[model samples]
Target: MSRRSVSTRGVKWPIVSAVGLHGGMDVLELRAEADAILAELVGAPGGSARLREDQWQAVAALVEERRRALVVQRTGWGKSAVYFVATALLRRRGSGPTVIVSPLLALMRNQVEAAARAGIRAHTINSANPEEWESIHEEVERGETDVLLVSPERLNAVDFREQVLPKLAATTGLLVVDEAHCISDWGHDFRPDYRRLRAMLAELPAGVPVLATTATANARVTADVAEQLGTGGGEALVLRGPLDRESLRLGVVRLPDAAHRLGWLAEHLDDLQGSGIVYALTVAAAEEATAFLRQRGFRVASYTGRTENADRLQAEADLQQNRVKALIATSALGMGFDKPDLGFVVHLGSPSSPIAYYQQVGRAGRGVEHADVLLLPGKEDEAIWRYFADTAFPPEARVRETLSALAGAGRPLSVPALEAVVDLRRTRLETMLKVLDVDGAVKRVKGGWISTGEQWVYDSERYAWVARQRAAEQQAMRDYVSTTQCRMEFLRRQLDDEGAVPCGRCDNCAGPWVDSDVSAETLTGAVKELDRPGVEIEPRRMWPTGMPALGIDLKGRISAKEQCSTGRALGRLSDIGWGNRLRPLLAENAPDGPVPDDVLQAAVAVLADWARSPGGWAPDVPDASARPVGVVAVPSVTRPQLVGSLAEGIAAVGRLPFLGTLTYGGPGGAHAARRSNSAQRLRGLFGAFTVSEELAGALARSPGPVLLVDDYTDSGWTLAVAARLLRQAGAQQVLPLVLAAAG
Candidate 1:
């Protein structure tokens, strides 16, 4: 936003008409507080400041909740508007000043500049000389500044923490965390620093609330975010839902080259109204797309992670105001920004995941107008995509390095100092630490580090990449991309099986592309035990009810915690409705929440199986307590014959969780091999067993002494569909299995 002669940018709404709390609290009161803040700014500050409806609600939530809240909003969800709005409201009520932990220098200054334009008093203390920083500190301490926005590192400074934090914490009505997903390692971008946010908030009194805002969070990403915030297990009231955009039109086009797509875009400029965004997979692509599109007769702008924030912001504004008809950019183009009315999001390459694609596409249609997402799917893009995934997860070494630096410092180091040891050059690391601060790993004060960011011991980027790639591969393995049938029918039916109704808003339903039906036999109906390969799973030692239990405590083996709490697992999954493709479906559907107890049970089972397996692995316990559980060995199969036979006994219970099947194949893989050998010795007593996908996959593909192996839960739809397909394949005796379950 900029101020110029006759511009509305700098103009503020009057007290009588300004925005207010969701309860419709008086805006006049907010204006008065802002006015008071202005009056105390060494002089009458200037114009007026107000917030939009969503901003007002965010402020009220932070002030009243007395706990951290994660706000999953849409693009154009104002980052600064909420804080200033809260400040304005509280100032009117005589509440303390607000402290905003911002991500960038330009963000702070841009906000300051906007406030300056609005005639409000605001400035940055960071990057200033000692004397200047002190001056700003005094202003904040004196409650002269209504809203003091500083980077997490700046706030972590010992000097800032000592003098300003406590004072600010007590009176500060709300602490706002913008782009909140930056806190989680699972996000599109990961920052180790974001892990320390919780301790920072604790510095304040019991009542000061924290506000977390983000544009998007996929299922797993959503969980990771909450975990970082100390509220993952259903403690905080989370507001999560896709920001429904009507004006955005999403389309997928399989294009061969950037030049071709850019040229096509130029030809469609009339439809775009000279206002649109073109997303590239990389900075190089952004630049090329920009140049090529520019030469094609459109004034194109571009930005990447390498672009300076100031210039990027200008490009954003230029694009928004129509100074530029279009912009070519990498994923870095739109964070903490609101350009609501752009007409299109043309992706030069397909995003690694649909969620990323969704978030980027969501940028358009902010005004709820027509917009489009043009994706060019290419396998070649995988390398670049992997680069992002690889980069998103910082190496464990860098994280450990950050921890070592923090441990060495007796007091909070300034932001610049903390980043010195970090190898990554991205400015987001510090900001990410701030995000992680919401999680318990890092500690913080308003001014700065009570503790530096926490260590994510897991190679999250690698793990995360594996999960994404795994999901992608799972889909490919099922071969839906090659399906010639009504894609919508197939996809929607899969979601329905997974409990997701047809959105009807997506391209498959309304787009020009149409698919004719193929044979019903061809579809992956619902994954069934018959389709899956199985394996052997025996208790490491029999339970107390059996010989396995007798062997464990009496002699050689593990502890209780490491042991599978079958009782706990049973209790947790009780509400999971007996499985059949749980993760992604639950992420989108579940009456209680995304992760049902059954799914939790599945997680626990993984540990139990690991315990039973020779490896002494406990799926849930990442640590040593994960010892062997029991030993009552039963061989399973990588193939379905044994599992299919078992399915005949169970009468098809709600579709096998992983592969829904009426009947699965018989003994195959190592499962049968082991059983064959054991059976010969034991005679008829040892035969191949069966399992549900939930049990099979959770227990490393061996379920209830049997195992299954088909590992993709993309939207959870394919699993259900595949299970159905297996059932149709009709080998019978089907069991279930999955290695890792993710949304």
Candidate 2:
């Protein structure tokens, strides 16, 4: 296990001396050795591959000087090469495995494979591979693993942090923070878990050679990350290069609407050269685009947060191997996907941050001569941006409530248990907890979270500043879409790239290369697809965890008899189809009125389609009792007219009785039911809807299936609780029908 014994491809690395020189080798000789290793790492033909000057400087700083460094280079700038070459050199001197904190699973997988190409043994311990943790840890302990990749969230796992992190920190040769922008609150993709690295950086035995690398950080983000990297008391070496992708030809395609944008894609996707990615702003949009493109005889698939991991892997492989034309993806497929020949990138809607947009489009044209990058900005882009921005750091009051609850618990409280006491949804709650954990306000223990009892002051000023920064970024994106200047230069300037200049390749600089004209046939088909309605609303089968703690006495599987049957919604609020039409009507500030005639017609069509579907209530089907004999409306605190009118209209169309609306008997009126977490929402909704005596009598008289109508279904708890009440009141079955599903 001596340092000299670690050989790759019959090349003997120089031994390290106590003075940190490679066996008395001078700088030039060491540089020669690094070049030789880089040749093997990149498979450079004839061993002629060499690192860029900056890449070489980074390697030398880490290996020879043992200094922390921050590298901000563009996507295809051989940043990975700097680390793998540094790992090879560092291990030659008998340093423990290099620990990499990568952000995404796609990035980790790509890094592992890339490491193998350079004769470095790399392993990952992510949520996706829990069963291999023990073996991976053993490999690291035995020095059989050269590189260990882990997600940033893994840094704070109670067991991993307490048991594994200390050992890794002590023996680590080099620490790499990939996608380093995430560590900065100023960055577009700020992640709280990344802040835990500050503690590890402080604990690192001096001169452990820390490196933080990113392709997306602007000047502000760079300064923040560099400052964090220097937490151990030595200034980090900052190496930033031009943030331009020479292989990219940028353009903006301004279409009239979602249908035209989709139509344009269908018309021109085949001509975009090799396989690529079609980026959508939401899961629904990605799925919608994927379905339309496939129906148009194009090979496509959807990749989003909701896609199964197995399917994501398959989709990645398909796109990599050109098995499919493209993967209709959200930001899930954004970073570190190692398709060097990706031919194009198309955004169905512009992202709110130009920096994020740059990071995504950088995935293309890595190894190729040129790749097309088009921004098809949508009118609804700003609305989608606002929806995502709603999950920013919670208010001071909410944070204090969470801390108070944890303090009063006297024991560790799991997130689900905390949901009963706190109002934040699961994801936002977890995010807040991570931030609090970093701030010394709370601690995650074996079971769940516990109050650290540390006097924590809410940083309201910092949070407000971050919020304003987000707003400014959104406006910048608006400017990007409308700017007549070079699109690439605009992005580069946003990143504060000093080397940014007009590329003379974008649509504004040169005449548009992409044909914006959508064929009449394609336009008609896309419009028809978007116009189609009725998405299945899968009913919740199990109550929220720890519901009994809310005094509802509900837990485990909801009884089959009490559960509402599968329901239907005209569309999802995040979808590209009916969502556009329904969003305005369902907006909080929208005027309360009867359902519009067009929307009513769409709802009626949804019901008809539901009745005719297999396992539906069509008379041609075998089951006579399946058909709803009457319609019951969930009393809408905000939109009673909309809900009642829709119910009456559906009942009239179907020749069924219109049962009266359920009574809103719960506390706090509509505000209480608007809680974010499922547990709290259920608690608010448990007694909210009561079947009135008139509705009870109507249900009892019908004694068959009933259509439970509502204006919207967000948590589905409103529908579930209302259905439970209706079922208890003598309705034989409850079927939920709604205008829109919340994304």
Candidate 3:
């Protein structure tokens, strides 16, 4: 192989070129042409800008030799530039428009703008812009579009896959996979949808160039992706660079608890260099942090999966323009967010994988001289990691169950319809279906998914290996937190960077640069904010789709007469304050006992606040109903003691009579129905609860309102079903209260 070297910031890096010239263009001529294009793409003064040697090598491999390549570099190393430059060069040679499979809407937006600066006309087709899809497709068909960007999910869409993908694959000048590490199941953020790219790759016309790029693939992930990229081509030329970011100053800030961690952020957020991101492990934590920060007079916004699309776009714009001090976010904002001068990144809890942490922190310090990256590791991080781990590829038996259900349906079954038969959660079931779709076990069409009747063997070995890999990565993250070695070097080494060395910038290399001390007042405020517990448990107003498929007549919205009032919970299990306290107690192995005194007190306080708050049962409210005349417990087979105690305590506190518990009239027992989808959960509880004669008499005596108590509420189906029974029996109004809520 012939190699070229470019000097950047006084360091020489080698670029490998494994192919000869094409289209009467020699290596030297191609290099000159690529340099000219780079200058135009970057809008350099008088076309003075030039391509780095490695970038030129990758470009040359694609344009001059029509070869596939993978580029693994740091966040700001110009991976997008490679594809844009190649697209320009390939188009000039009379090739077809480039097709780029991008991951995030933010990334696609940035790419479109960047391509314009280079004089390349770009268009995108994602879920966000459905109305423009027809026009965009026409533009591509007319050969007026320079590049067309589509999300991975778009590749498998029935219309796109059948109508658009074939034409695009046949005519595309270049194929680019941005954030390519997602294709590897071994990668920290593997997405099953990316696996569909293999079919597209295989369908490409011979000699079409391809480029895959990412910033956070270790050796294992790199190898996996490279192998996939070579599906049609002989081999992919991989150009991996050093992972060090000279502008990043990494450190760990150890705090006593969630309160201290949040308090430190409140006290020192402005002291950080500039506007940046504050990452939380869960959506609830992010929302909580955002609320507390705003209450403290800081301009911050929350961005999570639950955030509306318009709000997400607005939040991204706010951060880009420095309107907000920080965007408290979950992993939803992790990849493809482009901010050149993001001054700092503060993680409320360590991610399960060091590679994922590196990818997130890489968002900062990309274009600045120095940026701070701090990790405030929480003790609850491991528990969260385990919770997420449980959602991985379902057990072999579950997979078979899904396949059998599809096979027996005799026609297409929508995900919601499948949910009634399959016990998996909606998201998990959809993910499994996508994976099965790729494996040819199922096919998605106009109505929904249908069985292909393909013999699908469960790859238990691969799944087990992946699970082990996840465990190892989690352990590596724990080590990274406690390691005495250089923090940056540790991260680099985890990514298999052979050049990893002490950067002398991290807290481990030098002394900590961030202040850990939080003011007493700030700490008190944080504690108070966290201690105030009460999350509205929105009642399930509508039945789940495809309920009739399960032999149940329920459909559409549940009638208001049978519906429970919007209820309340002491706190969410994902909450930073109460979650830490409640997780262990509600854990599968935790001993079931009466609610603790502290929890009981918290529940009482929650009730007090609920009474006086707006739309509450306070007498001052115009249409306020009388307070609960009695309390009734929802029978809990797993924690009967806890439910009984909570109901009795609340009734005693309110000086209301304690109604007897609802009898368990089971088709399927209460505990047996746990963790299933809404339809399945409702089916299990349809007639599972019955108002006993004693409870019915108590409700008849009062007939005003009743407090329905349960140990926990996740799907809200239990409360909904139980409330319906009570309403049908006698109670005028039912208000549900629970110890903890699950997101």
Summarize candidate 2's per-residue lDDT along 1-743 as a digit string, tens digits: 12232222222223332234334557767778887788778665346466656677789899999999999999987788899999999999988899999977987888888788788999999988999999999989998999999988899899899999999999999999999999999899989999999999999997799999999999999999999999974998999988878789999999999999999999999899799999999999998999999999998999998999899899988988999999999988868798888999999999899989999999888878889999999988877886777778999889999999999989999999989888898899999999999999999999999998999998889989999999899999999988989889999999999888999888898879977899899999999999999898888889998887777899999887788888899999898889899989988789999999989999899988887887675233235337788998888767889889999999998889898888897665544455388898888888767778888888878888899998888888888888888878897778899999988
Counted clashes in each candidate structure: 110, 0, 0
Against the reference, the lDDT scores of all candidates come to 0.47, 0.87, 0.87
Q: What is the C-alpha local distance difference test score of candidate 2?
A: 0.87
Which of 1 and 2 is ahead in lDDT? 2
Residue-level lDDT of model 3, residues 1-743, one tens digit each, is 56676533232345554345333446667677776776666666354456666677788789878999999999888788788888988898899999999888888887788789778999999989999999999999999999999998898899999999999999999999989999999898888889999998999999999999999999999999999999987899899999999989999999999999989999989999889999999998998899899999999999998999899999999999999999999988868898888999999999999999999999887767889999999989998887767668999888998899888988888988888888899989989999999999999999999899989999989988998999999999999999999999999999999999999999988898777899999999999988888988888899999888778899999987788887888888877888888898888878889889999999899989888877675333234467888999998777888889999999898888998899997854576766889988988888778888988888899878789999788899999999999999988888889988987
- lDDT (Cα, 0-100) at 647 in candidate 2: 96
Ten contiguous residues minimizing lDDT sum, candidate 2: 1-10
Task: Estimate, for each residue in 191-288, the C-alpha lDDT of model 1 and write its tens digit.
Answer: 44444455566566666666777766656666666665653222554665335444545455554433334445555555654477777776645665
RMSD of 2: 4.9
Whole-model lDDT, model 1:
0.47
